[model samples]
Target: MEIQKTPLKDCFILKPDVFRDDRGLFYETYNQKVFEKITGLKIDFVQDNQSVSSKGVLRGLHFQNGEMVQAKLVRVVKGKVLDIVVDIRKDSETFGRSFSIILDDVEHLQLFVPKGFAHGFITLSEQSIFSYKCDNYYDKASECGIIYNDATLALDWHLPKEEFIISAKDLELPSFEEAIS
Candidate 1:
Protein backbone atom coordinates (compact mmCIF):
# COMPACT_ATOMS: atom_id res chain seq x y z
CA MET A 1 0.00 0.00 0.00
CA GLU A 2 1.20 3.55 -0.76
CA ILE A 3 0.40 5.92 2.07
CA GLN A 4 0.26 9.60 1.15
CA LYS A 5 -0.06 12.20 3.85
CA THR A 6 -2.45 15.02 3.36
CA PRO A 7 -1.82 18.67 4.22
CA LEU A 8 -3.39 18.13 7.62
CA LYS A 9 -1.06 16.44 10.05
CA ASP A 10 -1.76 12.76 10.78
CA CYS A 11 -4.26 12.44 7.96
CA PHE A 12 -3.37 9.96 5.18
CA ILE A 13 -4.64 8.59 1.90
CA LEU A 14 -3.64 4.98 1.27
CA LYS A 15 -3.59 3.39 -2.16
CA PRO A 16 -3.52 -0.39 -1.99
CA ASP A 17 -1.92 -2.54 -4.68
CA VAL A 18 -4.72 -4.46 -6.32
CA PHE A 19 -3.86 -7.75 -7.98
CA ARG A 20 -6.38 -8.35 -10.74
CA ASP A 21 -7.02 -11.49 -12.74
CA ASP A 22 -9.69 -13.03 -14.92
CA ARG A 23 -11.73 -13.81 -11.76
CA GLY A 24 -11.36 -10.72 -9.59
CA LEU A 25 -8.77 -8.88 -7.52
CA PHE A 26 -7.17 -8.94 -4.11
CA TYR A 27 -5.20 -6.53 -1.96
CA GLU A 28 -3.97 -6.28 1.59
CA THR A 29 -6.15 -3.56 2.96
CA TYR A 30 -4.47 -3.24 6.35
CA ASN A 31 -1.10 -4.24 7.70
CA GLN A 32 0.18 -2.95 11.00
CA LYS A 33 3.82 -2.97 9.91
CA VAL A 34 3.22 -0.87 6.82
CA PHE A 35 0.94 1.50 8.66
CA GLU A 36 3.51 2.20 11.37
CA LYS A 37 6.23 2.66 8.80
CA ILE A 38 4.21 5.33 7.03
CA THR A 39 2.54 7.23 9.85
CA GLY A 40 5.01 6.53 12.66
CA LEU A 41 2.05 6.00 14.95
CA LYS A 42 0.99 2.58 16.17
CA ILE A 43 -2.75 2.03 16.25
CA ASP A 44 -4.72 -0.95 17.38
CA PHE A 45 -8.20 -0.59 15.98
CA VAL A 46 -10.66 -1.92 18.56
CA GLN A 47 -13.89 -1.61 16.64
CA ASP A 48 -15.19 -1.82 13.09
CA ASN A 49 -18.22 0.09 11.82
CA GLN A 50 -20.07 0.03 8.53
CA SER A 51 -22.81 2.08 6.99
CA VAL A 52 -24.80 2.27 3.77
CA SER A 53 -26.05 5.52 2.31
CA SER A 54 -27.66 6.79 -0.86
CA LYS A 55 -26.52 9.65 -3.06
CA GLY A 56 -26.93 13.11 -1.50
CA VAL A 57 -26.69 11.63 1.99
CA LEU A 58 -24.19 13.31 4.29
CA ARG A 59 -23.18 11.65 7.55
CA GLY A 60 -21.01 13.81 9.78
CA LEU A 61 -18.45 16.26 10.94
CA HIS A 62 -18.36 14.22 14.12
CA PHE A 63 -15.77 13.48 16.76
CA GLN A 64 -15.44 12.45 20.36
CA ASN A 65 -13.96 14.52 23.15
CA GLY A 66 -11.91 13.55 26.19
CA GLU A 67 -10.44 10.03 26.41
CA MET A 68 -12.80 8.52 23.86
CA VAL A 69 -11.37 10.40 20.89
CA GLN A 70 -10.74 7.93 18.00
CA ALA A 71 -8.56 7.37 14.99
CA LYS A 72 -10.34 5.99 11.95
CA LEU A 73 -9.37 3.96 8.89
CA VAL A 74 -12.14 4.44 6.34
CA ARG A 75 -12.88 3.06 2.88
CA VAL A 76 -15.68 2.58 0.41
CA VAL A 77 -16.61 -0.92 -0.67
CA LYS A 78 -19.50 -0.64 -3.13
CA GLY A 79 -19.57 2.91 -4.41
CA LYS A 80 -18.02 6.33 -3.88
CA VAL A 81 -18.02 9.20 -1.44
CA LEU A 82 -16.43 12.53 -0.69
CA ASP A 83 -14.72 11.94 2.64
CA ILE A 84 -13.65 14.85 4.78
CA VAL A 85 -11.71 15.42 7.99
CA VAL A 86 -11.31 18.61 9.97
CA ASP A 87 -8.56 19.26 12.49
CA ILE A 88 -10.10 20.37 15.77
CA ARG A 89 -7.17 20.07 18.16
CA LYS A 90 -6.85 23.45 19.80
CA ASP A 91 -3.09 23.19 20.17
CA SER A 92 -2.31 21.88 16.68
CA GLU A 93 -0.71 24.10 14.07
CA THR A 94 -3.35 23.22 11.53
CA PHE A 95 -6.30 23.65 13.83
CA GLY A 96 -9.56 24.44 11.97
CA ARG A 97 -8.08 23.26 8.67
CA SER A 98 -9.88 20.51 6.71
CA PHE A 99 -9.04 17.92 4.09
CA SER A 100 -11.20 16.12 1.56
CA ILE A 101 -10.73 13.09 -0.69
CA ILE A 102 -12.69 10.95 -3.06
CA LEU A 103 -12.91 7.32 -1.98
CA ASP A 104 -14.28 4.74 -4.38
CA ASP A 105 -14.41 0.94 -4.69
CA VAL A 106 -12.56 1.08 -8.01
CA GLU A 107 -9.61 2.91 -6.49
CA HIS A 108 -9.54 0.77 -3.37
CA LEU A 109 -8.15 3.68 -1.43
CA GLN A 110 -8.51 4.25 2.28
CA LEU A 111 -8.39 7.30 4.52
CA PHE A 112 -6.76 7.45 7.94
CA VAL A 113 -8.08 10.14 10.26
CA PRO A 114 -6.27 10.42 13.55
CA LYS A 115 -7.78 11.35 16.87
CA GLY A 116 -8.44 15.07 17.47
CA PHE A 117 -10.08 15.42 14.06
CA ALA A 118 -13.70 15.51 12.94
CA HIS A 119 -14.69 12.93 10.31
CA GLY A 120 -17.53 12.85 7.82
CA PHE A 121 -18.54 11.80 4.29
CA ILE A 122 -21.06 12.41 1.52
CA THR A 123 -22.22 9.60 -0.73
CA LEU A 124 -21.65 10.43 -4.41
CA SER A 125 -23.21 7.40 -6.04
CA GLU A 126 -26.71 6.02 -5.96
CA GLN A 127 -25.65 3.78 -3.08
CA SER A 128 -22.41 3.49 -1.15
CA ILE A 129 -21.15 1.03 1.42
CA PHE A 130 -18.75 2.59 3.87
CA SER A 131 -16.60 0.81 6.41
CA TYR A 132 -14.16 2.01 9.02
CA LYS A 133 -11.98 0.85 11.88
CA CYS A 134 -11.84 2.88 15.03
CA ASP A 135 -9.16 2.81 17.70
CA ASN A 136 -11.83 3.36 20.37
CA TYR A 137 -15.40 2.31 20.92
CA TYR A 138 -18.45 4.57 20.74
CA ASP A 139 -19.06 6.97 23.62
CA LYS A 140 -22.27 8.90 23.10
CA ALA A 141 -21.67 11.39 25.87
CA SER A 142 -18.29 12.31 24.42
CA GLU A 143 -19.51 12.61 20.86
CA CYS A 144 -20.00 15.99 19.21
CA GLY A 145 -20.45 17.46 15.73
CA ILE A 146 -20.07 20.67 13.76
CA ILE A 147 -22.49 21.67 11.08
CA TYR A 148 -21.48 20.23 7.71
CA ASN A 149 -22.06 23.54 5.93
CA ASP A 150 -20.57 25.81 8.51
CA ALA A 151 -19.77 29.10 6.75
CA THR A 152 -16.49 29.72 8.53
CA LEU A 153 -15.13 26.34 7.44
CA ALA A 154 -16.13 27.26 3.86
CA LEU A 155 -15.93 23.70 2.52
CA ASP A 156 -16.59 23.25 -1.15
CA TRP A 157 -18.44 19.89 -1.12
CA HIS A 158 -18.68 19.92 -4.96
CA LEU A 159 -22.44 19.92 -4.59
CA PRO A 160 -24.72 22.91 -4.50
CA LYS A 161 -26.06 23.97 -1.13
CA GLU A 162 -29.68 23.42 -2.13
CA GLU A 163 -28.91 19.99 -3.53
CA PHE A 164 -27.06 18.71 -0.50
CA ILE A 165 -29.27 16.57 1.68
CA ILE A 166 -28.56 15.79 5.35
CA SER A 167 -30.23 14.35 8.39
CA ALA A 168 -32.20 16.45 10.83
CA LYS A 169 -29.62 15.95 13.54
CA ASP A 170 -26.81 17.07 11.26
CA LEU A 171 -28.80 20.04 10.07
CA GLU A 172 -29.35 21.06 13.64
CA LEU A 173 -25.65 20.84 14.45
CA PRO A 174 -24.00 24.10 15.52
CA SER A 175 -21.49 26.02 13.44
CA PHE A 176 -17.83 25.90 14.31
CA GLU A 177 -17.96 29.26 16.06
CA GLU A 178 -21.08 28.31 17.96
CA ALA A 179 -19.65 24.99 19.02
CA ILE A 180 -16.36 26.46 20.16
CA SER A 181 -18.06 29.27 22.03
Candidate 2:
Protein backbone atom coordinates (compact mmCIF):
# COMPACT_ATOMS: atom_id res chain seq x y z
CA MET A 1 0.00 0.00 0.00
CA GLU A 2 1.11 3.59 -0.68
CA ILE A 3 0.09 6.52 1.49
CA GLN A 4 -0.39 9.91 -0.11
CA LYS A 5 -0.62 12.83 2.24
CA THR A 6 -3.45 15.31 1.90
CA PRO A 7 -3.35 19.10 2.47
CA LEU A 8 -4.45 18.52 6.01
CA LYS A 9 -1.86 17.09 8.38
CA ASP A 10 -2.22 13.37 9.17
CA CYS A 11 -4.83 12.82 6.45
CA PHE A 12 -3.89 10.34 3.73
CA ILE A 13 -5.04 8.62 0.55
CA LEU A 14 -4.14 4.94 0.55
CA LYS A 15 -3.70 2.99 -2.64
CA PRO A 16 -3.37 -0.73 -2.28
CA ASP A 17 -1.65 -2.97 -4.81
CA VAL A 18 -4.43 -4.87 -6.53
CA PHE A 19 -3.88 -8.22 -8.17
CA ARG A 20 -6.30 -9.06 -10.94
CA ASP A 21 -7.06 -12.11 -13.07
CA ASP A 22 -9.90 -13.53 -15.13
CA ARG A 23 -11.41 -14.98 -11.98
CA GLY A 24 -11.63 -11.58 -10.33
CA LEU A 25 -9.35 -9.34 -8.26
CA PHE A 26 -7.85 -9.32 -4.81
CA TYR A 27 -6.24 -6.63 -2.69
CA GLU A 28 -5.27 -6.47 0.94
CA THR A 29 -7.50 -3.68 2.16
CA TYR A 30 -6.01 -3.49 5.63
CA ASN A 31 -2.79 -5.04 6.84
CA GLN A 32 -1.73 -3.77 10.20
CA LYS A 33 1.99 -4.04 9.55
CA VAL A 34 1.81 -2.40 6.13
CA PHE A 35 -0.56 0.33 7.28
CA GLU A 36 1.64 1.26 10.25
CA LYS A 37 4.73 1.31 8.08
CA ILE A 38 3.23 3.43 5.33
CA THR A 39 1.34 5.96 7.47
CA GLY A 40 3.62 5.96 10.50
CA LEU A 41 0.59 5.74 12.73
CA LYS A 42 -0.59 2.79 14.75
CA ILE A 43 -4.34 2.49 14.98
CA ASP A 44 -6.34 -0.21 16.63
CA PHE A 45 -9.71 -0.24 14.92
CA VAL A 46 -12.44 -1.24 17.32
CA GLN A 47 -15.51 -0.85 15.18
CA ASP A 48 -16.60 -1.05 11.57
CA ASN A 49 -19.57 0.68 9.99
CA GLN A 50 -21.30 0.72 6.62
CA SER A 51 -23.84 2.90 4.90
CA VAL A 52 -25.64 3.05 1.58
CA SER A 53 -27.01 6.17 0.04
CA SER A 54 -28.80 7.02 -3.17
CA LYS A 55 -27.70 9.67 -5.64
CA GLY A 56 -27.99 13.26 -4.37
CA VAL A 57 -27.94 12.10 -0.76
CA LEU A 58 -25.44 13.82 1.49
CA ARG A 59 -24.30 12.65 4.90
CA GLY A 60 -21.83 14.50 6.87
CA LEU A 61 -19.44 16.95 8.27
CA HIS A 62 -19.67 14.75 11.35
CA PHE A 63 -17.24 13.94 14.16
CA GLN A 64 -16.90 12.94 17.78
CA ASN A 65 -15.40 15.42 20.18
CA GLY A 66 -13.19 15.08 23.29
CA GLU A 67 -11.89 11.61 24.05
CA MET A 68 -14.38 9.97 21.75
CA VAL A 69 -12.74 11.43 18.65
CA GLN A 70 -11.86 8.75 16.12
CA ALA A 71 -9.45 8.14 13.27
CA LYS A 72 -11.11 6.55 10.25
CA LEU A 73 -10.14 4.50 7.22
CA VAL A 74 -12.94 4.79 4.66
CA ARG A 75 -13.60 3.37 1.20
CA VAL A 76 -16.46 2.84 -1.20
CA VAL A 77 -17.36 -0.67 -2.25
CA LYS A 78 -19.95 0.27 -4.91
CA GLY A 79 -20.76 3.26 -7.07
CA LYS A 80 -19.12 6.61 -6.33
CA VAL A 81 -19.07 9.51 -3.96
CA LEU A 82 -17.40 12.84 -3.38
CA ASP A 83 -15.75 12.09 -0.01
CA ILE A 84 -14.55 14.93 2.14
CA VAL A 85 -12.52 15.49 5.31
CA VAL A 86 -12.12 18.74 7.17
CA ASP A 87 -9.38 19.41 9.72
CA ILE A 88 -10.73 20.66 13.01
CA ARG A 89 -7.66 20.31 15.19
CA LYS A 90 -7.39 23.44 17.27
CA ASP A 91 -3.59 23.78 17.24
CA SER A 92 -2.71 22.40 13.84
CA GLU A 93 -1.37 24.52 10.99
CA THR A 94 -3.99 23.15 8.57
CA PHE A 95 -6.87 23.59 10.96
CA GLY A 96 -10.11 24.55 9.21
CA ARG A 97 -8.75 23.27 5.88
CA SER A 98 -10.53 20.51 3.92
CA PHE A 99 -9.73 17.90 1.32
CA SER A 100 -11.91 15.93 -1.06
CA ILE A 101 -11.57 12.97 -3.45
CA ILE A 102 -13.75 10.90 -5.68
CA LEU A 103 -13.97 7.40 -4.22
CA ASP A 104 -15.42 4.66 -6.37
CA ASP A 105 -15.38 0.87 -6.63
CA VAL A 106 -13.20 1.03 -9.74
CA GLU A 107 -10.33 2.86 -8.10
CA HIS A 108 -10.68 1.11 -4.73
CA LEU A 109 -8.99 4.04 -3.07
CA GLN A 110 -9.28 4.53 0.66
CA LEU A 111 -9.05 7.72 2.71
CA PHE A 112 -7.52 8.06 6.16
CA VAL A 113 -9.18 10.76 8.21
CA PRO A 114 -7.31 11.54 11.42
CA LYS A 115 -8.96 11.95 14.80
CA GLY A 116 -9.43 15.70 14.77
CA PHE A 117 -11.24 15.90 11.47
CA ALA A 118 -14.87 15.94 10.44
CA HIS A 119 -15.88 13.60 7.57
CA GLY A 120 -18.77 13.48 5.09
CA PHE A 121 -19.71 12.50 1.55
CA ILE A 122 -22.19 13.04 -1.28
CA THR A 123 -23.20 10.16 -3.52
CA LEU A 124 -22.40 10.69 -7.19
CA SER A 125 -24.01 7.58 -8.62
CA GLU A 126 -27.40 5.87 -8.48
CA GLN A 127 -26.38 4.22 -5.22
CA SER A 128 -23.21 4.00 -3.18
CA ILE A 129 -22.08 1.49 -0.56
CA PHE A 130 -19.54 2.91 1.82
CA SER A 131 -17.66 1.26 4.68
CA TYR A 132 -15.23 2.46 7.27
CA LYS A 133 -13.07 1.32 10.17
CA CYS A 134 -12.76 3.47 13.23
CA ASP A 135 -10.17 3.36 15.97
CA ASN A 136 -12.90 4.11 18.47
CA TYR A 137 -16.46 2.91 18.77
CA TYR A 138 -19.47 5.18 18.30
CA ASP A 139 -20.34 7.41 21.21
CA LYS A 140 -23.67 9.14 20.91
CA ALA A 141 -22.94 11.73 23.58
CA SER A 142 -19.78 12.85 21.90
CA GLU A 143 -21.12 13.08 18.38
CA CYS A 144 -21.29 16.46 16.72
CA GLY A 145 -21.75 17.86 13.24
CA ILE A 146 -21.29 20.96 11.16
CA ILE A 147 -23.76 22.01 8.52
CA TYR A 148 -22.81 20.59 5.14
CA ASN A 149 -23.53 23.95 3.52
CA ASP A 150 -21.80 26.13 6.08
CA ALA A 151 -21.10 29.37 4.16
CA THR A 152 -17.66 30.12 5.57
CA LEU A 153 -16.38 26.78 4.39
CA ALA A 154 -18.21 27.19 1.09
CA LEU A 155 -17.83 23.53 0.10
CA ASP A 156 -18.69 22.96 -3.52
CA TRP A 157 -20.78 19.77 -3.54
CA HIS A 158 -20.73 20.05 -7.36
CA LEU A 159 -24.49 19.69 -7.29
CA PRO A 160 -27.24 22.27 -7.03
CA LYS A 161 -28.66 22.75 -3.54
CA GLU A 162 -32.20 22.07 -4.78
CA GLU A 163 -31.06 18.80 -6.30
CA PHE A 164 -29.46 17.55 -3.12
CA ILE A 165 -31.24 15.70 -0.31
CA ILE A 166 -30.23 15.56 3.33
CA SER A 167 -31.55 13.95 6.49
CA ALA A 168 -33.42 16.03 9.02
CA LYS A 169 -30.53 15.64 11.47
CA ASP A 170 -28.05 16.87 8.86
CA LEU A 171 -30.33 19.75 7.94
CA GLU A 172 -30.34 20.84 11.57
CA LEU A 173 -26.57 20.69 12.09
CA PRO A 174 -24.83 23.81 13.31
CA SER A 175 -22.48 25.98 11.27
CA PHE A 176 -18.72 25.60 11.46
CA GLU A 177 -18.40 28.53 13.79
CA GLU A 178 -21.02 27.12 16.09
CA ALA A 179 -19.34 23.75 15.99
CA ILE A 180 -15.95 25.13 16.88
CA SER A 181 -17.21 27.34 19.67
Best by TM-score: 2
User: How much is 175 displaced in model 2, in angstroms?
Assistant: 0.7
- lDDT string for model 1 (64-117, tens) is 888999999999999999999999988889999999999999999999999999
lDDT of 2 by residue, 20-109 (tens): 999999998888898889778999999999999999999998999999999999999999999998898889999899899999999899
Clashing pairs in 1: none
Clash pairs, candidate 2, are: none
**Segments of candidate 2 deviating more than 4 angstroms:** none
| Model 1 ranges with Cα > 4 A deviation | none
TM-score of 2: 0.98
Report RMSD (Å) for each prediction in the order shown.
1.0, 0.8
**Number of backbone-clashing residue pairs for each candidate, in the order shown:** 0, 0
lDDT of 1 at 70: 97
